[model samples]
Target: MHEFTPPSGTLLGVGLGPGDPALITLKAADAVARTRVLAVPVKARGAESFARRIVAGRITPAHTVLELVFPMRSDPEVLRPHWQRAAQAILTHLDRGEDVAFLCEGDPFTFGTFIYVFREVARLRPHAPVEVIPGVSAYHAAACRTLTPLAAGDDRLCVLPATYGVEVVETMLERFDTVVLLKVKPVMDALLDMLARTGLTGHAVFVNKVGTDEEAVVTDVASLRGRKLDYLSLMLVRNPARVKEPVLRGCRPKVGA
Candidate 1:
């Protein structure tokens, strides 16, 4: 091992985008390449890492890679300390003037755990240079993989977490012409119920593990109830008003014009 002293350095949180290797941004690739140390988070003992799998073909063994074990379950007491320690580990590398890159799946800011590092690093060492490279979010990837569109014509689309309560989801369904729910692993039932209540269930589509080998898409959300899922998945509900026939009928009906 080697010794170290405090030095100015950059901490790059690079998003690998969705599972498709080609989707990774070129700039993100450069960040990974230049980093003297790469920090990849680990779940439990001997578990396959989703982030690592996304960038497996690009990383080299010569670079220093650190695994910070983060508990998958959300326990208020357990999470903060783990994340705090993880930030310290990363900061240690950065303190040595070594550029450290944290590999993230999809966009680092959207429903991402990297923000834990971002917050702590900001709190503990505010001067550290931080760079966040945008990557393909599961939002567009899920829609594209399922051959669906986020919106059509003048229709407005909203993207939100499916974990929202039934009341909020019901409001969103009525407000937006197209709704995309991200990180849908926990509240599948609530989402399905909202769709069913709105009578849009028949047209809803569920896409799981987008861009990865395990990817699966189902046009019927009704069949998806009570099943296992991935946090990386998303669903799209086609709006009737977004179709050609319906929109052509609405232009003359919206009021005096």
Candidate 2:
């Protein structure tokens, strides 16, 4: 006599968009609705989860919400254990044939906490079913809301965390036409100073909590100096005066001959 084993359920990384419930895609909503276990990331135990709040309306009594604590720190060693624990917790439900959907504020693979968990899950279960549902990133929403064109004909764009320091940011600004600085809370003043030094202060825009009711956009980025900013804030900078290589089209040079 032989005993049969049930197959594991799938792990769904659902991006809910940038703080806007309406921005969630139809497929993401369907996944959330069908999944019985909803794994949400929070800063601490019992803390509010921004990702969960984005899909509050979709949650029902039948759903089992699992809060995974992911502290706000950049130390990978400190975060690794948390990620492994979260992955194991989600896997437990999956082993029971219950699909687990991990909610994310933006695109799961774009600097989202889901990436860490996803990596751990893949390591733990090499053949586990997984699906990633993309959503509008914070920078994309900020650019669209500000009506700023990220890139155009031969223009380059760079997106990085502001914690990389002002020197690196300045170098990126020099190399790319458009630069998006994410999580500008710690280096707000330094970035503003660098922008002013590069004569791009007026071309920079600061967007905070984009797409939500408390969203704010600041055209005068200089005013943000010395002021505490939210972690969700980001800056979109455009350098129109950046030197571009001459493109020869039909025997005619676009720039100086």
Q: What is the C-alpha RMSD of each candidate to the true structure, in Å?
A: 6.2, 4.3
Predicted structure with the largest TM-score when compared to the true one: 2
Weakest 10 consecutive residues of candidate 2 by summed lDDT = 245-254
| lDDT of model 1 at position 70 | 83
Q: Taking the tens digit of each residue's C-alpha lDDT, what string does model 1 give over 48-92?
A: 678888988877877887887787866758888888988999888
Error of 2 at 166 (Å): 1.3
What would the per-residue lDDT of candidate 2 be over residues 16-133, giving only the tens digit for each residue? 8998888899998998999989999999999999999999999999999999999999999999999999999999998888889999998898888899899999998877899999
lDDT of each: 0.81, 0.92
The C-alpha local distance difference test score for the whole of candidate 1 amounts to: 0.81
